[model samples]
Target: MNAWSGRQAPSLEDFEEMALAALEGLPAPFRDLAREVTCVVADFAEDEVLEEMQMDSPFELMGLFVGIGMAHDGAAPVTGQMPNQVFLYRRPILDYWAENEDTLSDVITHVLIHEIGHHFGFSDDDMEAIEADAETEH
Candidate 1:
């Protein structure tokens, strides 16, 4: 049975509010980009995501990006190919925060920024630099 089968969870509105605050705490350009993005929370990773991402453990990943970046040809839609979205995995994120030294909000912000990096077609190196910059600014 799933761990969350009967547990109470924060409401969708509450989760969104928290995510928005996390995004708002990011650095300049990223903060601006995140304002135009939508964040969605899921209880766990989808079966397909587990298989495709080759996740041996359910708690390995905390979030995902599912839409085209602004660097892509056309605008990304919030649900379809045109909209951009960030998917937060609740169980995994919570597990990570509980296991690690980072704060929940910090972890959420990292995941949020990482996913948004995809939206802007940022390369891994680019993301590293951006993260470093954010860290210094913080």
Candidate 2:
């Protein structure tokens, strides 16, 4: 078995690294779009985040984005779209890792890319194609 197979809590910095690395693995176009976007990690979803996202519960949101989309072309302040940010809800991630066989880093990466995919307005089909291409490259 691989050395790091089990679920363990990731330090804040560790989570950031894994998330960033995952972003780096995306296609150049997608990676460029992700630039200027900040990534944050939290133990749980905040009340405001929950309300803003309209999440029924903390568990419902494993990640989130709040920012102006590239489509807007910076015509207005983010009051309507907000700054681009990717939020990784740490606790729920750990919970999923514990129950599943995947490593924590992989989970973080998936969430990171998935949220960034939201920024591009990529459909599920687009994401699947991207993911397939990424798998082939890796």
Candidate 3:
């Protein structure tokens, strides 16, 4: 008998659950700063997004940050501007999880923060520091 006979790959809904849980676990300060940022989970990156980002495959992109970041705003949102968004690519994240030793939650949290880091125009070093700080709180 297969030990995982009834198991199936995590659905988009499952990924959404993970994404929300990851977001909820973030430090209050960081979460507050990203309060307005919307996050969505999809099986793959949209074709246009992949093309724009110059990726050969959707699996190459784990997540994406879209819309104007706070760091770029000289003023508040314009009348018709869309809210900032983070797109988490499920298939790619699953693939990445499969190939790495890290736990699934860690992967999700990393991707979430990395995208948010881009929104805040954080450097790699800054992100690392933030990640380290967040870890200490957990």
Quote each prediction's TM-score.
Answer: 0.74, 0.77, 0.92
Stretches of candidate 1 exceeding 4 Å from the true structure = 1-13, 74-82, 132-138
For residues 1-138, what per-residue lDDT tens digits would candidate 3 score against the true structure? 898998888888988998898887888888888888899999898898889889998899999899888789833776799988999999999899999998788888889999998888888888787777666766
**Relative to the unseen true structure, what is the C-alpha lDDT of residue 85 in candidate 2, on a scale of 0 to 100?**
88
The C-alpha lDDT values of all candidates are 0.77, 0.76, 0.86
> What is the TM-score of candidate 1?
0.74
Q: Candidate 2, overall lDDT?
A: 0.76
* Number of the top-ranking candidate, with lDDT as the measure: 3
Ranked by TM-score from best down, the candidates are 3, 2, 1
Name the regions of candidate 3 deviating beyond 4 angstroms. Answer: none
Q: Report the candidate with higher TM-score, 2 versus 3.
A: 3
Clashing pairs in 3: none
Positional deviation of residue 29's Cα in model 3 after best superposition, in angstroms: 0.8
The order by descending lDDT is 3, 1, 2
